[model samples]
Each structure stands twice: as structure tokens, then as C-alpha cells.
Target: MTVPLLAITAWSGTGKTTLLQQVIPELNALGVRCGLIKHTHHEMEVDTPGKDSYLLRKAGADQVIVASDRRWALMCETPQQPLSLAELAARMDSSVLDLVLVEGFKGEPVPKIVLWRRGVKGGVEDLLDEHVIAVASDEPLQTGLPALDMRQPAQVAAFIARWRAAYR
Candidate 1:
């Protein structure tokens, strides 16, 4: 019952997020319950200042949870450690998901598609990794692996859905 984890990874300005923005709907159209995990290196604030959750967290609370009728968000301060992709993936409720689109963690060993284009920084590492499950690119690629259309999300979504089904 493991949720399939896939990634759309490339260097900055390579349209990783943009592509997923399109792909999410495509996944939805195909009836896939998708969960997304985004990796960021910069320090960020998910809780707001002056909010009770923020105030409590600021006063040395290790974790804070906030909820409304529609949704809830949890904020935890990890001063001692940073979570890896697997660690974060473990936090996902796999019972509610058919797929998890991991937006980064390019260095992690996992099944993924290496989104690439010329003039971007990802080409070299992609060539070195056999674990790269596919290539989604604008231009034609020489690799015999499945070459997908980065512009057409449907084609990419179909590929992913088939890959997801095959693994089950």
C-alpha cells in the first residue's frame, strides 16, 4: 500500500513547479489522488505573526496545530535536525493518496523523472543516474529512455498513470 513517489526535478528556472502546476490537474482528471511535498532550503514561516499558533510556537512550543472547518496546518520547529525526503514521505497518509509528487530532493535515490533542457544545470547528473525513470524535455533527447513532452501535460500524466498502474 505504499504511495508511489515521483518527482519533477531540475535546476532553477527549469520550470519544475510550472510543469507540476499543469500536471496536478491532469492527475486529477485521471482520478489520481495526488499529494505534493515541496522541498525548500531557505528558512520559511508557515505560521503567521500575532496569530495564536505563531505566538505559542515563538514561546518555545515544539509544535503547533491550527485548524478551521476546511483545513488544518501543523508547524513544528526542528532546531536539531532536518528531515530527509524519506522522512517527510513517511509523514504522508498513504491511505488517502495514489501518488506523491515530490517537487525536489534531486539528490535522493527514488523513482523520478529528470526534467531537462539545454542551458540548464541538470543535464550532467541526469546522465550519471540510472535511477532516473524518464526524461521530460522540450527538445529531443538522445537517451533511449522514454522522452516526454514537457509542454503537453496530458502526455506526461498518461505516462505517470501507466507507470503508477504498472507498479501495482
Candidate 2:
């Protein structure tokens, strides 16, 4: 079965990541195995220079995966090509996950929770698509979509749970 996917999107400083950091634990407590896919416009390095994994990648390994007792990480070289959300999701091990929480991809054609913080560079107005099913905002948003209090993680998690339940 295809795992359910939800994109949490907003402008910089809108607390999208912060909100997810709170909501994910609550969802885990409710027995939901959630996977995350975050998109970054800037270059990111998970491993430091001179590290074994870093050296492996530097040596031209297309995909370098390092696993330990505690955690495992994979560094795949995409070489400037932007992977679509669907393409990224396909790369994940979704068989054991109940939900996939995407941290960006605002333009993607997936259901999303748009985080709207006042005075931010972008607002809910930027998300004019019907795929945006909910809006989590510090202030009121002028839209018909369900407005969720940005400060309430439990409520947000509940909303996600309810939505997932309905789809199931």
C-alpha cells in the first residue's frame, strides 16, 4: 500500500520545522510511524570533511551509506538535479511507515498543511491550490481551509490523525 503523504509548507521563519518537531513525537505516541522528507534549496552536508563517509563520497561513491548501532544515514549524489517530491518518496522505505511528512515542496500536488506566520515573507495567499487542506497560523487566514492554531501540536496531530483515519 502507498503510504499517506502530507507536506508541511511555509515561508522561511514561519516555524514549519519547529511545528513538525513538536507534532512528530505526538504522532509517534499515537503509534504512527512517520517518515520525513525535507527539501533544501541550499547545499547540505550531513558528514564532515575527513570523515570516513565523507571521504567515501569524495572518492566518488555514487551513494554512501553509513550505519551504526544508533543511527544510519545515506548520502546520495544528485548533482544539481532537483528531485520531485514523488521521486523522493519513491526512494524511501515506505512499507513500514504510516505517514510521510514532507518539510517543503509547496508547489507539489500533495495534501499540505500551510504554516502561516504574520509578517513572514510569504503567506497562505501563496498557496492558492486546493491540495492545501489545512492552514496552521498564528493569526487568522482568509481561506475556507481548516485553520489550526500554530501553537497547538496536539490539535495539529489530531487533525492529521483524523484525516488519515478518514482516508483509511
Candidate 3:
């Protein structure tokens, strides 16, 4: 079965990641195995230089898998073609994940929870689109859509849990 996908989308400094940090634990407590895919615009490196895995990757290896007793990671070089949301989500093992939460990719067609605050770059309406399934804000908002209090991660997690249930 295809795992349910949801996005926590917002502008920079809107606390999207912070909210997820809290909500994920609440989800775990509720027995939802969540897999997360975070999108970043900046250049990022997860491996340290001079390390075997890093050296192998830098030495023209297109893909490298580093495994240990605890966990494993696969690093693939995709400089030529940027990965799409579907591609990234497909990389996740759906058998173990009940839901996949995307941290960004607001422009994508996936359903998302739009976040807003009293003083931010733009209003919640600016982010509204057909893909938006709900709106979470620090202040009260009457947008005809499901409104969630950003301060309470439990409430958000409960909503997500219900959403996941329906997806199944």
C-alpha cells in the first residue's frame, strides 16, 4: 500500500521544523511510524570529509552505502537531476512507515498543512492553495478549513493521527 504523504509547509522562521519536532514524538506515542523528508535549498553535506564513505563518494562513486550495527545510510549523487517529491517519497520504505511528512516542497501537489503567525513574512491566505488540507497558526484563524493551534503539538498530532487513519 502507498503510504500517506503530508507536508508541513510555511515560510522561513515560521517554526515548521519546530512544530514537527514536537508533533513527531506525539505521533510516535500514538503508534504512528512516521518517515520524514525534509527539503532544503542550500547546499548540504551529511558526510565528513576524509571519511571512507565521503572519500568514496568524492572519488566518482555515484552511490555509497555506509552501514553499522545500529543503522545504515545510502548517499547518492544526483547533481544532474534534482529529485522530485514522488522520487524522494518512493525512496522511503513504505512497509515500516505509516505516514511520510514532507517538511517543504510547498509548490508540489501533495496535501499540506499551511502554517502562519501574527508577525511573519506573509499572511496565511498567501499560502492557500488546492493542496492545502489545513492551516495551523499561532493566532486564531477562520479560513473555512480545519484550523489548528500551532502552539499545541498534541492537538496537531491528534488531527494527523485521524487523518492517517482515514487514509488507511
Candidate 4:
């Protein structure tokens, strides 16, 4: 199976995650199985405080696996180094996913669809590069790249589907 990876990127308040909320379902309707990787700067916790797994982690356990009848979650504590996007994707269950949509990692050399909003710190000029396959924006841009309206999820999904086909 050919698993393709694409990225959605924009400034902090530009709704990268919000767009994925709609795009994932749209892609599903189009028969595309999706996985997502999100980048964050804050220190995040996957285990709830005061829980057994949390306690074990706080006591210096490097990794913890919590499993139940319905699901299983693996939390690894690595304060020294973080996993790269490729590293994280390698750990995904490849048998079920057809595409991996990455959010952020704007500087990484990857095929990315950038989102541009008016007065959102950076303009399309900053987003222009060979890896940027398209631009989804609230305002018209002159970057000569294919631009999609931000209000239309179905249209965006279609564009992604076409790209995914070519990518495959």
C-alpha cells in the first residue's frame, strides 16, 4: 500500500486544526483513510494526573502502556529529545492508514498546503516555495499557486484527493 503524507500549515490562530476537523470527514467520504500528526510547543501530558499511569511516569518510568478492552494508549516520556515527524509516522499502524496529514512543521521540507488569512501575521509570500502545493485562504492571493476558498471543505477535500491520487 502506498501511504502518502501531506501537511496543513498556518500561523497559530489561522485554524489549521479547525480545517482538519472538516477535511478528515470529507476525505473519509471520498474513501481516503487518514492519520494526523500535530506539532505543539507546550509540554503536553497524555496521562491524567493522579492516575496510576501518571504516578508511574512521575516516579521516573520512561514509558507507560495503558490498555483496556476497547483501546490502548502508549505514553513515552522523553524530556531530552523529541521525535521527528518521520520518526513519529514510522510508529503509526501502517496497515490501516492511507494518508497522513501533518499540522505545523512549516519549515520542514514536505508537500504542504498552506492556509492564509487576512492580517494573520504572514502573507502568502512567506508561504511560497516548491513544497507548497496549494494555498487555502480567506483572501485572494497573487502567488500563482492554486488557491481555494476557506469556507468550502468539500472543494478542498476534492483538491486533496486529486493530489493524493497523483502522489500515489
RMSD in angstroms, all models? 1.4, 1.3, 0.7, 1.3
After TM-score superposition, the amount by which residue 56's alpha carbon in candidate 1 deviates from its true location, in angstroms, is 1.0
Candidate 4 has what TM-score?
0.94
Per-residue alpha-carbon lDDT of candidate 1 for residues 1-168, written as tens digits (9 for 90 to 100) = 788898777777788899999999998999998999998878899888998889999999998889999998878788998888888888889999999999877877888888887898646355437668888889888777888989999999999999999979
Could you tell me every candidate's TM-score relative to the true structure?
0.94, 0.94, 0.98, 0.94
**Winning candidate number (TM-score):** 3
Off by over 4 Å in 2: none
The residue-by-residue lDDT of candidate 4 on 1-168, one tens digit each, is 647789998888999988999999999999988999899989788789999999998999998999999999888877888988888888788799989999999988889999989988977788777899999998777778899987788989999999998886
Range of the 10 consecutive residues with the lowest summed lDDT in candidate 3: 117-126
Quote the RMSD, in angstroms, for model 1. 1.4
State the displacement of the C-alpha of residue 110, model 3, in Å, after optimal TM-score superposition. Answer: 0.7
How well does model 4 score by local distance difference test? Answer: 0.88
Give the per-residue lDDT of model 2 (tens digit) for 1-168.
Answer: 888899999997889889999999999988888999998888788889999889989999989989999988888898888677888898889778999999988888999999988888965687658898899998777698899998999999999988887867
User: What is the RMSD, in Å, between candidate 4 and the native fold over all Cα?
Assistant: 1.3
In angstroms, how far off is 98's CA in candidate 3? Answer: 0.1
Clashes of 4: 0
